[model samples]
Target chain A: MSTSTTLEEPKTGTWDGGNEPLKASYGKLMMWFFLLSDAFTFAAFLIVYGLSRHSHLPYTGSPEEFQFSTEWWPIPEKVFNAFPGFHGVDLPLAFVALMTMILILSSVTMVLAVEAGHRMDKNDVQKWLLWTILFGGTFLGCQAWEWTHFIVGTEEGMLLADGTRIFGANMTMNQYGPPLFANLFFFITGFHGFHVTVGWILLVIAFISTVNGVYHKRGHYEMVEKIGLYWHFVDLVWVFVFTFFYLI
Target chain B: MAAHSDHSNEFQQTGEIPKAQTKVIWKTFFILVALTAVEFLFAFTMDAGTLRNAIFIILTVFKAFYIVAEFMHLKHETKALIWSIILPMALVMWLMVALISEGSYYFDSIRNYFN
Candidate 1:
């Protein structure tokens, strides 16, 4: 029966439906597939994070005793409260919130650029793309500042009653409750930041192509739309990271 | 009337312009901003517990879908394409739940035995 089924004639052309059953362009569909795989990678990282956090030694007891039990995780707000130019002020989550806003704004500009591309307005496309690049660059700069601030070590830092001082952050040690917490923070946010950098490069190329009238000659600006899909995917990933890493 | 006809021909030369979607894009932007504000509010006000975490996850998923729908134009795509992307994500969710729960269970048992 299996051999008989194998001998059946192949369905070609209309009989097989179109090559792209979803009707998506090759580039767009490939971008979706890439995003799907990347999503799984992030999901694994986060699941490991949850597992590790559930097993970490949590800070407890008073300053005199300073007990550690496998029952607590570092509170994100207490760790990420510092903001640029504010220095001593206790502004919990302010800096990261600003970073989130900047990223969201960049996503808006990316969509605007794609929309302008649809109009075949080269000037508008260039303008919006430039704005998107600027916003993305600002977000990158903010991340750099945040990373530096984290590595510099606060004045108080984390002091134990036994006079053990934990300062700065690394794979093996962090002032945060557990080293695993810092490990996950660097890996997840660093991965997301790398995506933002890739989006920046893609936008710059799309901008240059727009200015050179390449898309204009093509009679469509689907290139801008394709890159826009990537930029928005970066933003979508940030939404999950923000909630999981920073908030919850 | 002649100028209007010329404009229509110009549109024909180019693909259909999505000028109408500008309003929708801005609306999504504001909605996202509002959601971020709500998240920050919860982060500051709500206690760290299951309820707060659940709310954050729900809100984050809402933001993710809104961005995919409006910004990526996934919502306007064919049902097959949407399902192709969404259905696979369900497996990711399953993996997350399975791994986290199992890991936590093991940790709980190990901690109890050691204590």
Candidate 2:
């Protein structure tokens, strides 16, 4: 049998001219994708934390005979109650609020740096980038102090029945109601801190590059914009972490 | 090449000094600060319960939206890009819902079985 040969016109799919559908640079688009994926990672951690908190056995007995019961979970306000230099004071969430402001201010400085980059004003870009770095470093210092306070377990930590002092935070145990609670705290906050540190290094690099007139040579300050995205994403993740881990 | 030189000249003329963005940036900073302050206030005042937690989640989402829109320039980007990020996030939310419900069931079973 002879088959009828039909030459059909090929249908064209979506047109992508290698142009950014978002009008963003390839770098920025990729940065956004990375951040979105990072967000899911953070979400998984926080959701598990919430689930653990929901199922945790709260400490109901006295300090000396501290025991975990399924009845209650340790209050976040009670756990994170200590403040810097106020050794005996229970300033719940005050220092953390300050930390939040520091991150916000750093984000502001980062945007200012990007704004200066847009103007191609190298001096302002360098100045603002340096300020952003300073703020990030300060925030990191505060986090270090917080971790030290948490690990030292001066007043908040409790002794368990097995004679294991739930001092500081590790993967195994915590003075907090449940080991999972502190584990999530350390992991989530540490992950976020790592991001902040990376962003700070990137900022420093961007500062040097700006000083060296790299973007000036490239005819645009898009590198600054890209780094700003990363920095702001760090701050953005911290917002969620603060809400779930500290505020809630 | 003449084309390469023209491209550089065009880029030079396009990006003018953006003073307006600085003002917008400061405004966003203050809004974030104020929202954080409000969160702290609520944390201190409101009783630790579901309602307070819901409000915190709402406020956090709002802050996240503002940061992404203004700082990340998502507001100026195309709808396709915005939805690409947001729609995938909805899937994350679904995962959260599914996993959290599963966790609740597990907790109930453990509590009922052991206690």
Which is the leading candidate under lDDT? 1
CA lDDT of each candidate?
Answer: 0.83, 0.81
Instruction: Encode model 2's per-residue lDDT on A156-246: one tens digit a residue.
Output: 3566667655566666666665667767878999999999999999999998887777788787889999999999999999999999888
Give TM-scores for every candidate, taking all chains together and pairing residue i with residue i: 0.87, 0.86
DockQ for every prediction shown: 0.44, 0.50
Q: Give model 1's docking category.
A: acceptable
Model 1 chain B worst lDDT run, 10 consecutive residues: B5-14
Tell me the docking grade of candidate 2: medium
User: How many pairs of residues in model 1 come into backbone collision?
Assistant: 0
Stretches off by above 4 angstroms in model 2 are A1-18, A58-72, A162-166, B1-20
Candidate 2 recovers a fraction of native contacts equal to 0.66
Looking at candidate 1, what is the lDDT of residue B61?
A: 87
Report the number of the highest-DockQ candidate.
Answer: 2
Residue pairs whose backbone atoms clash in candidate 1: none
Against the true structure, candidate 2 reaches a TM-score of 0.86
